[model samples]
Target: MEKPQPVVVKVVTPEDREEAYRIRIEVFVTEQGYPEEGEIDHYDAVATHLILVFPTSDTPRRAYGTVRMVTLPDGTGKLGRLCVAAKLRGMGAGALLVRALEKEAKEMGLSAIVLSAQVHAKGFYEKLGYGFPDGGVEYMDDGAPHVKMAKTL
Candidate 1:
């Protein structure tokens, strides 16, 4: 058994946005059965997108995970559209993506960060210092069960 190499996560530039969307499409639309049209939305235009990439000698690097952060009107940061390539899910890529988003949120002077996490991933978010508001409640989003979680930055 061997440990997987760490990946570099960074804010996506104009040229890298496509790769971020690609990973989201693969994980959300194709794999999770989300509608193609709903996979992308207006938030993408204003949000700061982050992508996890494995360094390679290849000309164009591929993204293994992605997440986006948008500053709300109230000054809180919202994290959404988190996804990791199927093959890289258990390799800490998702956690790396989240930590990157948290760092970005703090840099922007946000008071807190929030996300609507899929039900199954609640524990994962909890481990990352996110918690449910008012004990715990579930809601439906994109036809999947999700819960709201927040962490102060």
Candidate 2:
């Protein structure tokens, strides 16, 4: 079988922020049943890299996936609000975005990178070398269970 083409990942520009928001709305709000407010939280307007992924297409490109990274006060990088569009999930978009974010984190000299992986996706993050912390905290967001996972940069 022929391989699917790769999605291009990049740091979103101001002009692409709205497109990123729309992608998040589709994945987190509509598909996951999260409230509109919950899906677009305060951090979105603050310190973060709103990463956007676009597939090579003939027509106007669409936002395929996105994730936000924030530098904490202590210098640890946190990845959150990750979402891959439903139709594009198996095309490796999510993994590509994560790898791109890790590269950004390394350049920032972050001590570690952490994220709260949804329970169903813990194994996915595990495959990326992230693991649950010993005293890891768990919580539910919009009814989905999540636990903290971290990897040293």
Candidate 3:
């Protein structure tokens, strides 16, 4: 039997926010070919950002995934920019990031959490309890197809 990797997800501190950005760019921009222009947006300034890290004795720590929650006008938390390193995709990193944000949203008294999930990743989000609302439609974001989904908290 093998031991599971130690994964820690935390609120990104002001100084460490850049680490989150780096992970986002590495996954979204560099690996997925998303234009760098719109990767970081105005919402990021006010949104609560989370960073998922893998800690090892060989080094202090390394950020492996990231996600953010932006409170919408309807008071629902909007989950966006979820990115986990390509190498760590199946290691449960993305789910950890989403769960961390869900915990934060619940603490903030949010009724639900919404997201525009990339079409291909829809099943991943679905397994986490997010679903498309009535009349939800596919939309384009950053040159990719996305559909809106929400999960009640």
Candidate 4:
């Protein structure tokens, strides 16, 4: 059997931001029922965005995943808005996106990375070495339960 081709990940440029936004809209807004207006925020202007693309010979490269990272005032990296195209979930695209974001965080000299993970994906973040804070607190965001998870770089 042929191995699947690896997806390419890159820091978003002016041209690529739209693709990242599109994927986020599909996952967070249309599919997950997040508020359309709240799906975007001021952070988008200052954050560093990442995009994952699958290459093809017959058609344009397809954008399948996205995530954004922002350096917090306390000097850690905050990762958010991570999403993979529905058709590509469970195929390693999400992991690839997280790895890319972690590398970017390291390159930015961040001491740690933190994220508010949806409750359903807590195990997924745990597998990637992120863990909830001591005492295990949960909070609600946009009506969905979430936990704060972090990993030291």
TM-score ranking of the models: 1, 4, 3, 2
Query: Per-residue alpha-carbon lDDT of model 3 for 1-153, expressed as tens digits?
Result: 565464655654654588888988998889899889888999989989888775555343467888898998897999999988888888788898898899999999999999889999999999999989955689998778989999999
lDDT of 4 by residue, 10-117 (tens): 654555777888889999999998888987899999998888885556334457889999899998999999998888889888888898889888999999999999
The deviation in Å at residue 18 for candidate 2 is: 0.8
Supply candidate 4's per-residue lDDT for 148.
94
TM for candidate 4 is 0.91
What's the true lDDT of residue 21 in model 1? 89
lDDT of 1 by residue, 1-153 (tens): 565465655654665788888988998888888899987899999998888886666445678888998899988999999888888877788899899888888899899998898999999999999998757799998788899999998
Q: Candidate 3 regions off by >4 Å?
A: 1-4, 56-60
lDDT of model 2 at residue 153?
87
The TM-score that candidate 1 achieves is: 0.92
Pairs with backbone N, CA or C atoms under 3 Å apart (clashes), candidate 2: none
Q: Give per-residue lDDT, candidate 2, residue 102.
A: 86
- Model 2: residues >4 Å from true position, as ranges? 1-4, 50-52, 55-61, 135-137
Clashing pairs in 4: none
Which is better, 2 or 3, measured by TM-score? 3
lDDT of each: 0.85, 0.77, 0.84, 0.84
Stretches of candidate 4 above 4 Å error?
1-4, 57-61
As a whole number from 0 to 100, the lDDT of residue 106 in candidate 1 is: 88
Question: Against the hidden reference, what TM-scores do the models get?
Answer: 0.92, 0.85, 0.89, 0.91
lDDT of 2 at 68: 84
**lDDT (Cα) of model 4:** 0.84
